[model samples]
Target: MQSSSSLFPVALISAERRGDLSEDVYRLKPGNSPDGTVELAVTRLGLAEVAESRGVPVILLHGSFSNRRFWYSPKGLGLGAYLARQGFDVWIPEMRGHGLSRRNRDYAKNRVADYARYDLPAIAAFVREQSGQIPHWIGHSLGGTTLAAALGGQYLGAPAVASVALFGCQVSRTYWPLKIPPVEWGGRFILKRFAQLSGARLKRGPEDEPIGLALESMRWHGLFGRFGDGERDWWKGLAEVDVPLLAVSAAGDRQDPDWACRKLLEQVGSEHRQYLCLGRRQGFSGDFGHVEMLVSKAAQVEVWPLVERWLKDPLTPVTGAQPEVLAVG
Candidate 1:
């Protein structure tokens, strides 16, 4: 295979050995988008030394107001660490303006469409170039929604994705007030007043989110909303996606409810697809919330194993025969 790094200038920003984990951080400059705005930073994580060369490659995408640290903490107490120890090649990328990624020229205007069309393909190319494999993508919240947009738009096709697993991702959730023109316009007016939202102040997460994200979301969920980019209809395009899929929804997540999540999953054309809802009714110890479903200690034990199983084999039928599937259901 040709080296993708040669096609795009990718700088090795840093490399560190932390006990059992070898962290290789890289920065790729994909230059400017179609709008003539340059993206300064697109950073990716590679945990390779301890990774099993024979194991499948996996990329973990953090939610909004987050970075690669959501998958791997400094203390090595994250899902990325757990996967690396179990022999998977884990690649985590911090979107532009998040974590080590510096704010770009279009930082204030950055939206999910930009991420799906530019950032993700860049990350996928670099990861494939390095690992020589199509990676399984795992994303949370906005990260998952971006993945959906990429697949739905056919921006990142089967050549780039081996499979996808979405956590707390949905597009069907109705914002009734936003459906009202006056209300929608009013909300947009207020959001445009601010350049960005403070993650620390809002207690959303560690990093801030651009107002552009909020703006685009409002447009999508508003009255004349449809999930897609300026080029294609993402929501409608989802029916064409043929890759394997694992859609996980947290029942306690009022943010992105189970029904909506399942609706997104049902829209996908993939024959190899599974849906798992985490709640007490499903026999899970408790109803997992948006973040807690993945970040909490309970997820470490219950959810991680199911993810592993899905990665290994996504076609397994959920005949309600398996304990893990039942619990995850």
Candidate 2:
């Protein structure tokens, strides 16, 4: 069933053996989205070494204005690399127009809706085809939001996702200006003029983000807005998702506060869901920012192990005190 959607052939774009880290990059030109002209460039990072015991497949989705490097640095020193060393079949996917994934016909109009409905399912199908198992998903920031949208919209369902770990993600972030009709329309008017937002220009990250994402977000936060596309109500649909969920938040993340992240977790209907907050108040070494919570050295020491533990046994809540932060199981 997973292989059915292998509509576009995956081309092995690059294969390089870098020390202990084996990298095989693939590119999938998956036709197009509902908006006829919007083709997709979905790139995957597959670790080549045959695992000692065929570990579980894990897919890491990078956030907005970012690329596959968010999970695995070029020097083989990121969470994805660490997981590969630990015997996990790690697959890092660069979303449309990010990294090796080139822009499509409707590049300027690309939105999260397209990502949730088309790109993710295609990635899942391809991963399931190769791994022969339901893959665990780890998404950060906007990546997590897209994951939630996919789950909530029922575009990606059980037997496709073994478990999900969301880091620094929430849809409830209030944009005060968008609450007003004039401001909302005005902002959209201004944003639509740009084809894409440059990461280098913004100094936010390495990759550029399509203006469609900005427009989509504006619609979501606009007055009388809701969290879903025209077809589905993702906010309402979230209650139907019943998988092992781990929503992680950082106290110092002004971008996505713990309360909002927890709110997203709370809406899920998962019987086995855990909320982990990283902060000094929670006994963590220090308060973590949005990006640092996953990429920083402290995260590698403290949070990465916790993430591994969760992926290994998501149903088993992390109980008792630990040297790390306290998690609401």
Candidate 3:
């Protein structure tokens, strides 16, 4: 039921089979992190029929108010399962205080900075250590923002990652109201009143988000605010990130619009980069909303193949009529 790795403390939770696929859950304790010891639950899925054939690792990150369920469901459905079927060892990590990862000592105080600088690197290191290969990363919404921050801050080096893909991720969206002093103070006051935001009440999802996330966003969009903490400027640091990167934005995603997503892709200094807008114009069935972008049945048919292709070879131009991918190498 439990075990530990040599360097990174990893405890296996359970291992079972779904049809012909193998699913394993493990908890990673990042005791070395300055942020304090917080355990993270990670799920690994692969072929059960193949012997000694754990496919290459690909980490799928969930957005706000979500968990590993965002990428995988109990019925063994979702992108994580799709990749497993495609010969990929898929990994899904639940952020601190989310899903199987219990609330840490500073759960309510956690921020994207903490997630980017510490949790992500810990998860990546564990994945790499276990797989014996560099892993590709894909994050959606807040997950993508965290991945971007991690890359921009140089927390996860290029050597440790094979490639990176972000879905519905951006940080350049400016809310002019947050720039006003009165509004900023008022917003902070209102946010500070609540320890956590109810996801079900807000109709966002099932998991509640720590109010720290809202406060962090408030600061990021505040007057003269940048996407970094006191120690680094993530926006400027992005100019030096040189990994194979792919950014996908949905046309109907007003939360993080396509234009902003494109801008984030432009900010990355990767020579091998790509930008994709999913909509009818781009050969998708319909304009995908923030959540539908990755979770819909259409996405399984049109988008999953492209994801597989990117993981397999980031530079390969997508050749298909159903999904039009814009390559920006």
Cα TM-score per model: 0.92, 0.93, 0.97
Residue 303 lDDT in model 2?
A: 88
Candidate 2 pairs with clashing backbones:
none
Candidate 1 vs candidate 2, lDDT winner: 2
lDDT of 1 by residue, 1-329 (tens): 33237647767777777667778777777763664444334333335464435467889999999988888889887888787777778888888789887787768899999999888887888788888889999999999999999999888889999989999999999989999999999999989999899999999899999999999999998899889867799998999999988899998999999999999999999878888898887868899999988988988987887788777776674433323342121
TM-score for candidate 3, residues paired by index? 0.97
| Model 3 ranges off by over 4 Å | 1-3
**Model 3 agreement with the true structure over 231-323: per-residue lDDT tens digits:** 999989998999999999999999999999999999999998888998999888899989988898988888888889888888777557677
What is the Cα-based TM-score of model 1? 0.92
- For model 2, the superposed segments whose C-alpha errors exceed 4 Å read 1-7, 35-53, 319-329
Q: Rate the local accuracy (lDDT) of all candidates.
A: 0.83, 0.84, 0.88
Scanning candidate 1 in windows of ten residues, the lowest lDDT window is: 320-329
- For residue 166, give model 2's deviation from the true position in Å: 0.4
Per-residue lDDT of candidate 2, residues 133-187 (tens digit) = 8999999999999999999999988879999999999999898888999999888
State the lDDT at 208 in candidate 1. 97
**Could you give the C-alpha RMSD of every candidate to the true structure, in order shown?**
3.0, 2.8, 1.4
